[model samples]
Structure formats: C-alpha cells, structure tokens
Target: MATSSFSSFILIFSLLSFCAIAIPEPRPASWSSKTFGPDGPWNAVEVVIGGVGQNRTAVFPGHAWHSWFTSTDYCFLTSSDHCNDAGGYPLRNSGSSRVSMEFLQPAQEWMAGVRVAGEDGFMYLDDMDLLFKGDNTDYITKTSLAIISDQMLALPNGTQYPALLGCLSLGSPEANQTFVEVPGPNLNGTMIPWPLAKRGATPSSSFGLHIGSGITVARMQGSLFWGGYDRNRVVGDVLALDGGFYEPILLKNIAITVVKGASPFAFPSTSKPGLLAQGNSSLSSSAGLPIVIDPCSPYLSLPRSTCDAIASHLPVTYCPNLGLYIWDMTSPKTTQILTSASALSFTLPGGTNTQTLTIHVPFRHLNLTLSKPLALAPTQYFPCYTSSGTRASVLGRAFLQDAFLSANWESSRVWLAQAPGPNIQPGSNPVGILPGDTAIQSGGNDWATSWDGFWTPLSEKQANGTEGIPAPAPVGAGNKEGEGLSAGAKAGISIGVAFFAAGLIGLGILLWRRGWIGPSTSGFARQESEIALEGRHSVEMETAMPNSSRGGGWGPVEVAGTSVRDPIPLGEVDGTSSSSSKKGLATSGRHVRSLHALA
Candidate 1:
C-alpha cells in the first residue's frame, strides 16, 4: 500500500509539470508588441467625422458621399515654397525633404493632385485638402513598391481603365509626364495592371485591405486598416473566399423578413417572409442574381424585379418637385410605422468544415435622408435604386455598417464578420492577415498551448534567460487611486477641494443672511413693498397720455369742423365728488406732464 501511494504522488507531479510546460504566455499590455512579427498588425489611423482638430475629424454634410479628404500643405509643380507660408519668401530648406504627387480619386465627380514630398512637402491646404502625414507613409511606400495604382476598374467588355496617379514635372514642359500608364491589351484578356498581375508569381509585392466600421453614427470615426484587421472588432466567424473577377466579393443568397409592422404596400401571399436564395439547389428564384459589395456607393442597387418586390413593402413616395423618391416619414406616425419593418440577411457559401456566414441589416439603415447634392432640399429617402438590365447588384454602406470586411489581396480572398453594434465597447487587440491562407486561427496565434498556463505573477521572475512579461498598468492609477500623482499634485488637489468646500459654505451663509435660503418676515415685507411700487408705476404709466397729446391738453375733445368743450374734472363736475377722484386726476396729470418732458 505504501509503494502504490508513492507511485500515485509521482504521477500527479509529472502531470502538473507537463500542463505548465504546455501553456502559452500572456500578451503584453502595451498598444503594440514585436510578438506578432516585425510587419505589424498595427492600429489603423482613425478617420473621424465631425470633430475638432486637423485630420482628427471631417464634416460630411451628406450621407450620399463616402469620400475621405485630409489637409495637404504641398502642391504639384510649384517653385514658390512660401506661397502661403507665415514667413517671408525663400525660407530655410531642410535636407530630409522629398517630393511625390498624390492622386485623389473619389467616387464623386472630383479628383485632385496633391504634392506629398520635396522641399514644399509640409504645406497646408484647406479642410478638403489631402495631407500626407506620417500615417500615410505606409500607403505611399506600398504604392511605390507596386509601381502602379490600385484604383483600376475592370469593365464588362474585357476593357480595363488604369487610374492616373499624377503628372510629375521634370522642371521643363517637354519633360513633364504622367507617372503610370495603362498597359496595352493582351491576348488573355486580363484586366489587372501588369504590376499587380505579376503578384501571383511574386507574393512579396502583395498587401491587404481592412475596412473598419464605427460603432455609432454620432461617434463614427471609421478606420481603414491597410494591412490587417482588429481581431476584437469582429463579431462572428470570418468567411473566406477563393477569389473574384470584376466583383471581388459576392453573396450566395439574400433573405428579407418583415420583423414588425405590416408591409406598407403588398407582396405575393405565397412569399410571406421573403427569401431570395442562390447557389443551393433548394432556392431556385435567386439563382442567377450576382451581388457585389461596394462601399463607395451609399445606396443598394438591386435588380428591377427584386427591387420592386422589396419596394412594395416600404413607405415611400415619388416627389417630382424634388426630383427624388422620398420615404414620406415626415409625420411621426409614418416614422413609427417603420419602427421594425424589415430586415435584410445576406448569406455566403462556406465549405464543409465551416458554417455559412450571414450579415443582418435592419430597416434603420435603409431609411435615411437625402442631403446636399442628391436633393434640392433635405428629404427623407430610401436608398433602393433599381436597374432593369443584367448588371451586377450592389450592396453598399447600408449593408457594410453592420458587417466588417477584410480583403487580403495577397491571398486573393476576403474575410467578413458581423460587426459589433454601437453599444459594444471597442477592443485594442489587432490580428495580422497572413498571406496565402483563407483560414485564420483565433488570436492571430497558432500555438497549441493554453494562454492561462503561461500567465505568471509579475512579482516572480524566471531565473533563466527569459524575460518576464510586464504587468498591465494599475487600474485607475492616474484617476481616483492617485498612484500617478506627485506630492505637489496631491497637495494642490487637497487645497482645491478645501477651497471649493469653503466657498460653498460661504455662499450658503451669505444666502441665509440675505434671507434667500428661506422666506423671512423682513425679506417678504421688502418684496411686497417693491411689488406694490411696481404695480402703482404700471398703473400710472398706462393712464399717462402720449407725448404729443400730453403737450396739447389734459382731457379735451376736437371735432373735424367744430370746436368741442373739454370735460371738467370729476371733482369739479360734481360737488359731491370724493377727494380720491381729485387725487387720481392730479396723479394722472403729473404722469402725463412727466412723459411729455422726457419725450
């Protein structure tokens, strides 16, 4: 029995040691670390709307446009370095100056050429200017490496339109030339630029595109992560696709359900809860419809038949005067009628091992207002444009607001997740988009060990060469805990508190002494007297005659062609008149005389 007990003790000790060795280490608390490799999963610069400071936020007047603009200090081909400089002409030059032109192309009919480098690099333009701050360096470097613009559009007729980067001046008119040119047509009918076309063979030249959604409309500081995505922001599993041609991302099926009120119009009784499915053999009606995700467009462009089916249930009307279809929700009842009218669900094809992905869109996204360029006057409108032809259907910002998209160009695959709602707190954990793989492991780490096993108390350090991970900053250190406060800071805070308390007490005492705290006899009497005087003054002012009449006479009547005798005073007219009447008349006459004198 003693030998068996000893053996069991040895076995337990071995099992504990193995478990400890198998656990993974906890991540550092800093904003970023080198654990994810040198090419970071860095935090994307936030692009805020309607806030303070330069590049901190931009005011978007209308909901139609999604174009981003930043302030730029430099202009192309300008020799005047101090055009808008605060200093005089020919200011000091720096050795680190470099010059590059930035071509800004928005979905709107506007384009601009911004100078990003050289001696005139740090010049400032207006609020609409595109500034090349330090944050833009990554994009700039990636553009230079690719030696081509990524804004190319593939047409339906096997034609490709290469976007213009900008025209760079070589100091002379003849030497000035465009930076990137479109390659001639090829036999294979490939639409991709030559530089990006070779990306398949040369994977090193590839990059990723990550688009982040802001939680709330008011605090909508959306982010565009160029290389990777914030792992914490994603709500559901990330669905990956092999690749796409003209429309890179596609949806397999679309299901529309009216969650609350009755449809504003009518639909077929057979299709109570509308379901438009594709790909699966069961859903026949929605088999041929192709859907594309386009953030550039603010509205969802659907096929005419599908749009008609959906529109039949919406409470909208065509306003010929405004030249737009308004979602006549001006009335409170009409607005309430659509409290929870409809919901749109998008389904994507997933492989056997993975579950299919679906993104849900509420009626709130579809119900928006037209502002600025889209309308002559601001009007409530629904964004459901229809196209009868066999053009690819588009899912715009209305769909993306609730969905997070991560496009990895290197792998030619896109990962999408259901975005967290506005109420959800944002997390700082970011995960890198690895090249060539559609499948992603959670936490951006593939280690088999558990994270808890590696978590050691910060007070203990390993005697070996391995360094201990620093603990997270103490909670409320700089706030209520006063851990970050200096001796002088603590003293100042105490003094301030004391002064504030004393001031409050002094104010209360003064209010009490003045009988303002509660009603006192003397204070009440004084108020009553003031009120009585005001009442008397008002009566006297009302009885006083106009200045012109006051100077003319006291109480007389005039006829157009006849003289009328003035009426005698009450006291004089009747011998029985009281003394009060005489006093009132005298007071009135005195008030009338004073008014005339002031005038």
Candidate 2:
C-alpha cells in the first residue's frame, strides 16, 4: 500500500508539470553576485573558512580539532547536476594548517566563493557547504565513515566502490537498512558505461542504474530524519529540514562612521563577525564567509575613462581624499557624513547589537541592489611592509549597522537616508559626491568658457548659465558693423555740383538726338544757321552740273575696235554716286590726238 501511494503521488506530479521552469534566487551573499546575483546563473560559489579566533585540525567532519559552537562534527557538502559521484566532503579551518579535502561518493559538488587571508597576506578560497533539503533520518552509526577516492572498499557483490567513485561506509545497529530498489520502467535515468564492476558488492549497499542518453549520476549523503522521540536521542538541529517560520535572524550590524588616518566609514573590528578575520578593514558576508572589498576591482560600476584618470592621481590601494556619508536604519531622515575624526564613533541609544550588522549596499549606476551586508575582517601582515593591494573601505559591518543610503547617478548625488543604532548620531543630509562627478562639476565653467561662441545645438544650457553650450544668434545676422550699414541703404541718391553739371550735358545731347525740338530753335542758334547755308550750297552745285552736261557723253569713238570712245563723263553716271565730274578729254583712236588738237 505504501508503494502504491508513492507511485500515485509521482504520477500526479508528472501530470502537473509546467513547461516553464522556475529559476532559484541568488544566495544571500553579495559575492555570489560575481557569478549569479543580478547577473544570472552560475557554475560555482566560493568561500573562505576561518572563524573569530578559531580553526580546524583534522580536515574531516567528526574528527575536527576545534569547533567552538558545536561539539559533533559537521561535514560541508556541495551538489548540482555535475560531480564525481553524489557525495560531499568536510571543510577544514585554517588555524590547523591542513590544506587538502576529500570526498565520499560520486556526488555533485560546488566551491563556495569565500576568501580567506593568511597571516602572510595571501587571500584565497577555503571550502564550501552544500545546500540541500530532504529527510533521511534512519541512521545507526556513530563512527559515520566516509570513503575517499584513494581508499579501497569491498562491496557485498564482489565489487569495489573506490575503483571508480568512492563510497561512504555507515554502520547501522538496526536490522532494517533503508535500501529501496525502485522497480519500474527505467526509461529516463543516468547511465554509466564502465567496463568492469568493482571486486566486492554488498546487499546492504545502495546502487542506482541509469538508462537514458542525457542522464547523469551523482552521490549524496543521508540527511538526519526524526521519528518517535526517545530519551536516548542521537539527533541534533536539522538545518536542512526545518520549515517553521521565525522572526528575522540577526546576521550582522552595519554602521557608517568617521575614522582618522583611514577611509571614512571605517569597517568592523578585526576580531568580530565569526568569518574572515584577516584585519580591520572593509568587508562583507556572502555564502557564509567574509568577502573583503577590493575597491580596485574592475567589477565596480565606475566608468572606465574616469577610473583611469583617478588611478593616475591616486594609488590603487589608497586615496586619502575620498569620503562617504550614510544614514543609519533607526533615524531614517538623519544622515551623517564621516568627514572628520570626531564624528567617527557611533553609540546607539539602546546600545549597539553586533548581530544586526548587515547593511544593504545600493549602487546607483549599475542599477544593482545588494542585500548582503559588508563586514570587517582582521588585518593580514605580509612579509614586506609595502602592502600595495586594495584595502576594504569603511562601509564594513560596523559602519553599515548604523546607516541607510541613497544615491543618484544622474546628479552625482548621494543621500544618507537614516541613522541605524543609538551610537550612530543623526545629522543633516550627509551625502557624498563621486570623485569623477565632482571633477566634472568643478570644471564645467572652464569647459563652457573654452567652447563659447562656437556653433552647437541649442539644447545645452544651464539654469544658472554655469554649464552647457551657449544659445545661437538669429539667422542672416552679423556682428555690430553689419547692423549699422543696413539702416542707410536706399534705391536712389545724388552728389555735389560737379556731378550735376555732367548730368545736364548728357540731358541736352539726348534731347537733340531724339528730335524733341527743331535744330533752328535749339541751343547755339548761330551754329544752326551756318549748317543750313552749307546744305543750300551743296544742292546748287548738283543742279548746275547736270545742266552743263549735253545729250552725248564725251568719249573716244572708233570703228571696228580700232579705239574705244573717250572715257564717259562721271557727271552723267547713276545718281547713287556722291558727285559728278566735268568732261576733260576725248580720243577717236590710239594714234589720234585729243579732240581739241584734232579740231
């Protein structure tokens, strides 16, 4: 009946499947964002291991040398669709100096994006814990043996587990082992193409067979389960199985305070915040470990060109001129700027609580919001005194615990929304301007002055006339000289006396030639009379010359071409000729003399 019920539930679940798959939210840490925050899906999350003044020894789960909070061993695990098998391994702390980790089964695993700093000044990831939710409580072993890949183990059926992927060996005092052979149509499951099985196999061991093309295999450990409560109980807090609702759990307190000889808004103390205790600087918590802020990280939202300019003026590790202001959570309207040393310390009204240390970091330019809070880790000492790397800013846990903040990218304005704890006193709008924005604001006037008088779009103008391109002049307009010349322009004009005399002479010539009046009555009367007398003399000469000419034209005549008549008199020629000439001589033949001589 139990098997039938389980089958029915599986069928129902398959039928109710939706085409769209829901994506999981990012883990609580801000560092996870490097891969999966607002960015998207990620392959891994890394973390640093090392608590406040505590460390691990054996590098295994139960055999650990130190664990201040819990007595029993707690092994960290990782899982997804990818891994050697499905098993996980234990994470070790730094104080013990053990550097290697081991896994039990062919389980899927992931790295925690945690960073740990050594006394020598090196920073790196330590270990990660797996996220799982399930209950498998029936366990009978106190030893809780985990088989490593290098170890040799024999199975009940002539097979060895560590041959390919290792197995975790657990001893159960009870006779009934939780081994359920899921028998059904194995149409879609993980398939392995291993050529040979291991040497020993056991009936009590769990084995899974795979059958599909895309299916894969992984290993997982048993989760503690709860049944009937007994006086002699071996169970403990099941963080993975608890589903009850509770009040908000205090993670860490954040504050913004002023510090002398350090960046404004100093971080929490080095010894606090049970994770990543490298030194007192700026840091945050994500994936259960401290994530120190590297202000120089390229992932910061500052523009590339501006960042380059700033890097040239200041060292990559430190910038003394930089400042910040933040508002605490308690006083929403009160903002405090960490401008000087005296304003650094924060004292809450009810006394500050260290647990509520996480603060939300808002990035105005990236359009990103970080829910994870920043923390301050211990300072690391390097071999040389040249510590040139980036140090975390004052926006660490201690400062975040006491402030609220808002920033505007367009205006380059940042506002501290409120004060948090009682120690964080209230103030007016204690906000900051980003360095690049400040530089632009200060240099705007100079830039505008340089670009003035040049043609540009009309939209660029400042309310106070401090920035932007100036307005253009009207079309068809020139400078001062052009305006004055335009006022006197006219269609007609006259000049002085000499010019007037020339004009009158031209008028008289035009009237005479155009026949406006007779020449006799025109100007210069005596000249007109002489011209008429000359015309009469020419007419009389023409008439008298025609009368003098006789009927026959004077010329030399000859018979049979002996001689041509004398040249004809020009006076008897056609009237088109200007004048007629008198007859001078005539000849009868070539040998004949003139007519007068012949007579």
lDDT of 2: 0.18
Candidate that scores best on TM-score: 1
List where candidate 2 sits over 4 angstroms from the true fold.
Answer: 1-57, 60-111, 114-599
lDDT of 1 by residue, 71-131 (tens): 2222122232221221111112211222222212121111111101111111111111112
Give every collision pair in model 1.
70-129, 71-131, 73-123, 73-124, 98-117, 98-118, 99-117, 99-118
Please give each candidate's TM-score.
0.41, 0.15
Return the lDDT, model 1, position 24: 28
For model 2, residues 1-599, the per-residue Cα lDDT tens digits are 99988655544443332111121111111011112211111111122233223322211110100110111122112121222222223333334422221111111110001111111101111222211112111111111122232322222222222211111111111111111112321111010000001111111111110000000010001111111011111111111101101100122222222222232122333111222212323312221211211110112211122233222211122212111111232321111111112122221111133322222221101111111111022111100101111111112212221222222222222222122111111111111222122111111112112112222222112211234323332222111111222223322223323434444454445556787646465441111000010111111111111211100101111101100122222221111111223111111111112112211
Clashes of 2: 91
Question: Could you tell me how far off, in angstroms, the CA of residue 329 lies in candidate 1 after the best superposition?
Answer: 1.0
